[model samples]
Target: MISRGIQSNKVNGTFYPTSFILVGIPGLEGAYKWVGAIVCLCYVLALLGNMILVTVISASSGLHKPMFIFLSMLASNDALLSTSIAPQMLLVFWFQKRYIHFESCILQMFFLYSFTSFESGLLFGMSFDRYFAICQPLRYGSIMTNTIIVKLVIFLLLRAVTLFSPCIIFIRRFPAFRSNIVNHSYCEHMTIVKLAAADIRISSALGVAEAFMILGVDLLFILVSYCAIFHAVFSLPSKDARLKTFNTCIPHMCVFLSFHGLAFFTCLSHRYGGKRIPPFVHIILADTYLLVPPMLNPIIYGVKTKLIREKVWKALHKCQSPHVK
Candidate 1:
């Protein structure tokens, strides 16, 4: 039979070890399959949920306000995030055609990074929104105006693109080797760079640096923002008002923990000494970052965000209702 599979890129002599390759395969196979299913599910829900969010928040006159603008932005960002990885991931897992065109791979990496960064940025934005609503309720309206929201959205898009652009440029320009197979299910930066036949020390270094850059730095910002928010919540005079404010943020906060924690620990582990850790552990942590977050976001957001549940119920009811004459 003709060779029925895509050729994978591999490390050449004196580079990474073959043992490294063997370790991740079985573990990755199972993990990717499970994660892949969840990702597919998330893509469906995210599509439905976010579209409804955009529609409901847009069509409803009461929701046509500053807070809803950011909510819509969150929905749109989640949609972009799922689009970045879910479909391609499901395909890579279900089929044996594991190869991606080099250019296409570059494009995918660009987006994967972009959307993920956008997510991180969006979470930070959400926290900021909560901060304004609770801490500076008097100024929330003026601060989160349409013009300001537009500016924030534009800034977020630009930041995500810029943060991830370097990886694409570096990889595409780097001299590639005969081995081109990427071991992971998705086009991830560190995993892809590992396939580089040429000297990739700089890329690897940046890869490590980027991990800390997001976690140590971005996470710090998130924590500080939340601290301020908590302080404001406690200082409020009415216990009922405090409870209501906290309730409003429970969904966003839950999604934030699931995604940010996984992304941070996984990437940090890989960046530090993952090469020494058994490839199975590496595979689970490394690849899971891409797969798990996309899958988890929908469930966490869908369940936690009351509006998502209501919209889903509305759609279901509408479906079950008989057609009118």
Candidate 2:
């Protein structure tokens, strides 16, 4: 019974909404303030942790290796990804400001997906760095030089931008919307696409294709890289040498598991959990997936890597010394 392109807001032949309403978590309206506080705490932690990692890496010339460079990139991306979602989410939760401008929603959707793609690409590149360092030590220098790293990063940025640009265009082209009420906290792609009264098969299909292309392919390559790395480690003649080589890979492997494990769980729950799981639970899981990784990655790296641990302690000591004065 809904009219197409005939709402109070219309432009040309399309139903152009000025804003969209975001219902933070259905069935949990009473706890909005509590949830807002928790989300704010998590955002602060993620931002501080990631920025510390970036600063440490940049200030220490000793950490200028290819692996550290990739870690810096990952940290920067995590900070960005979390920043893109948390402020808007807090606004909805805290101030009863549930409405987001249409242009802002599109921009949020673009950044949310683009940073995710960048993370996958950076992780894949880190795996390659590991493969070369462990499996081909002598040529690692020649293969992963500064020039090569810059080129790889440039490629990752371009790939993410190219792949997600169409999403913005497609969202703008919808002729009408069933409603402007988005069910989740942020302007997630599928949620936005579902609002269209017109067919969304193309958008849905592109989303699937993009997910497989980025996550599936990158995951496959990482697994292959680790397999070869493990094989090389096991074949080493001495236990000490093998142990040393394997230790270097442990942090990267842990990070890879954390990011991908949460991602797959979120994806599967949405796709198959139908009536078994509550909607609020799914939204919490999605939010956790974005927040937890940023907070955890730097902790994992700082603790596991001896040099980084030393640098962090030194920095802490220096700060305390200034306070004592």
Candidate 3:
């Protein structure tokens, strides 16, 4: 089951949100709101931050180029990622009931997968952007245009949808089980897949294949992008310019590593050493990967893009300016 209509699927074999403690904490009511609150806040921030990015891209005449267009797409994925998980998580946490219908759970799973895949692809795209800028400075302007960016966005969307279609096929194989307990607040893909009463060899294979495909391809592309970037940086005329480029990349790389890298770590831990790991530890790491990055993305971009701060002050000054007589 996915994430969509879990509340509606409370009865029958569809899916239900039963009252249960979240995975991170000991029990349901005593101390989970803190986690829920943080998650919800991140979602809110992501939504607003993305909107601001979209607005800035739209408003600024100077920013109406290919790079900002791609940034807008990445922001869109970030918004989707936050929206898919945060609202339901907040509702369940506050009300003490976390029943989710099977169909709804499946829908949610689809979105979660789709947005994340799209994000990874977008990061790969950004790496390409940087590569072109650094490596082929003269050609960068011609290579990235509005038409090309739009086409790339469409391609990424279609690819994400196509790649995740197998997840649905695999999910349908599970027979209805009596127990409806979901170890997590929102039906995480791995959490539900682990509970399948039926043989999930196919699903397992698909999951692994998807993981490797997305992670492997994206990493390869990113590596190529950075390799080109390194060449350019090394060939730069000044040491200060090289330092500047690396400094610009540091935050994005940290965020990139933290999000996908943590997922890779958790998958490995579960595969070879999960038996020894405590549930709380598992939950904390999983939640960290989910909740932390959305909050940080805006901060990273805002700091990296000085224009955002300048625009903010400019707007504030305009707002405080004296009214016309």
TM-score to native of every candidate shown: 0.81, 0.90, 0.87
Question: For residues 49-108, what per-residue lDDT tens digits would candidate 2 score against the true structure?
Answer: 889889999999999999999989998999999999999999999998888888899999
Per residue, candidate 1 scores C-alpha lDDT tens digits across 1-325 of 2122223333343232221121223456766566566667667877776776677667667567665666677677777777876677667666544656666767877887777777777777767877887788899988888888788779878977776677777887765443445566566677767776678888877776665665456667777778888888888899998887687666566667777777876666656765677756665665556555555554555555666567667767989999999
Instruction: Give me the displacement of residue 325 in model 1, in angstroms.
Output: 6.3
- Report, for every candidate in turn, its global Cα lDDT versus the true structure: 0.66, 0.85, 0.71
lDDT winner: 2
Q: Can you rank all candidates by lDDT, best first? A: 2, 3, 1
Q: Please provide, for model 3 over 1-325, each residue's C-alpha lDDT reduced to its tens digit, 9 standing for 90 to 100.
A: 4543224443455443332223334344476777677777778888888877777767777766666777777776788888888787787776665666667778888998888788888888888887888788799989877677778878888888888788776765565443456677666666676665567667766776787788668877887778778777888889999898988777777877787787676556655566697656676676677667776776786548777667656766878999888
Which candidate comes out best when scored by TM-score?
A: 2
Residue-level error in angstroms, candidate 1, position 251: 3.7
lDDT of 3 at 116: 77
